[model samples]
Target: MQRALLIAAVCVAAVALWLWGFGGAEHVTVWAAEGQRAAQNAMARGLRSLRAGDPGALTALLGLCFAYGVSHAAGPGHGKILIGGYGLAARVPLTRLCTLAVASSLAQAASAVALVYTGVLLLNWSRSYMQSLADSLMAPLSYGAIGLIGVWLVLRGLRKLAARNGDDGHGHDHNCNHAHGPTAQQAGAVRSLRDAFVLVGAVALRPCTGALFLLIITWRMGLAWQGIAGAVAMGLGTASVTLVVAAASVTLREGTLARIAAGPATTRALGLVEALAGATIAALALQLLLRAL
Candidate 1:
């Protein structure tokens, strides 16, 4: 049973890594990317209408922005990898993980608004220049942070596994890591607010292009509030998709823990998942960085 559960968990992780690591099944890639692009196009058109100030345009714009956020998140270049990767490794509660995803997505939107606002109002830089600045400076920093976090996760997972192995005949509490549920038994091992902040920072580093474009349009059109509201809509859309990914990651880990009867084996399996997730994240970040450079 232990081996079977471990195999299942490993298979789930493998499939996710394959699909997201750049060279998954070709059809999956095309369909997902195309869908994302379509959503982006729809969002662009919606922005135009909202800017025209027709009756009910504000509500319509908000709806469209929400939809766009969902699709945009579904596409790529957000922080799906980070969210998903952390999900695989951490034994954290799925609910908390989902909440973090929401926070991170909102932070990303806020970053976009702050950047564009600073450029247009405070610095007097034009739209084109702001976009360029984000593309060049902010994008790299975001990718770099993601890559570093991935490496950190990988190292942490490896160390955990190694220390577990070194336990040898020590006969320490194997279930020490199972610190969940009520009471003082809540193991803080699986949860880390620092990690949440880092992951949020990773996504927030790069402002979304759509947010930048839409904001610039609204600002130029003298509808700054619309731009702010639209940005929030985008964040909500992104949070929805991100939460789904985070949920999946949590489910897999939980399943593995539940199915594997042996406490020690469960810990080992989790470590393996964490290690794989970290490697995938690092690889994806490097790929993005290289392309950006």
Candidate 2:
């Protein structure tokens, strides 16, 4: 009874911490905001020098952009949360997970530059309009997609749980002779790529504010090339941060799974945890969606 009570207490505390600190969009966190501010300062300085024809400033600007990327990534954003949470629930390869992180970050940088450049140069849309679309439209869409992914995860977990329960009586010879439905491992792998795609889309669709700011300033100053370079550097830095976090999550989750036995109790526990993670993610995302609407 004590053990159960203790576990319940810990779970409650964890959920509170996540929802209050890690999960809340309102609490963007002081450190991340500071990093963002520092990056903005660096970008402003870099833009000023580049406009003054000091070509040497470009190198310094790129370095600051990278720093900004790292810091921006450290913030409480949907990308990091989704990646880390998925890593906790799924058994994706570390390399593949890291690959997705890098790709998604770069995609965000690319999207910001692409949208801005295209809007300003080709479509003749104002920068304000572009920013508005990113905040009002793209962000909500991404959050909505994240909620849907959560639902999918929950459904998959429930199905696995049901399958295991159904096969409880035939546990002895069913595996050796009678073919069963998809094993957990097989089912997880089948959707691994699909999950990666959804997460990538969720992250990529949201533009980085710093990247957009730099692009707009540089474009106006006739140094679009420098802006592009800096944006790439920032994306790389963000990817680096995300990769480290994801690697840790993957290692921890895999290690935990490795220790669990094939017994029904353990299997049931795994299913519940998976479903709970999905529920947490979905609830957080839904909160954001509601706020947006």
Candidate 2: regions farther than 4 A off: 1-28, 179-193, 262-270
Question: Candidate 2 deviates by what RMSD?
Answer: 4.8
lDDT of candidate 1 over 1-293, digit per residue (tens): 55655666677778777865757746554665676577667766766677666688788878877877876776656488889888877777778889889998999999999999988779999988988999999898999999998898899778767866766456667468753222212322556668778889999999877788878888888888888998999899889989888877776776677675555566666667778879978998998888887
**Model 1 misplaced stretches (Cα beyond 4 Å):** 1-48, 169-190
TM-score, one value per model: 0.83, 0.84
Model 1 steric clash pairs = 179-187
Question: What's the CA error at residue 204 for candidate 1, in Å?
Answer: 0.3
User: In candidate 1, where is summed lDDT lowest over 10 consecutive residues?
Assistant: 179-188
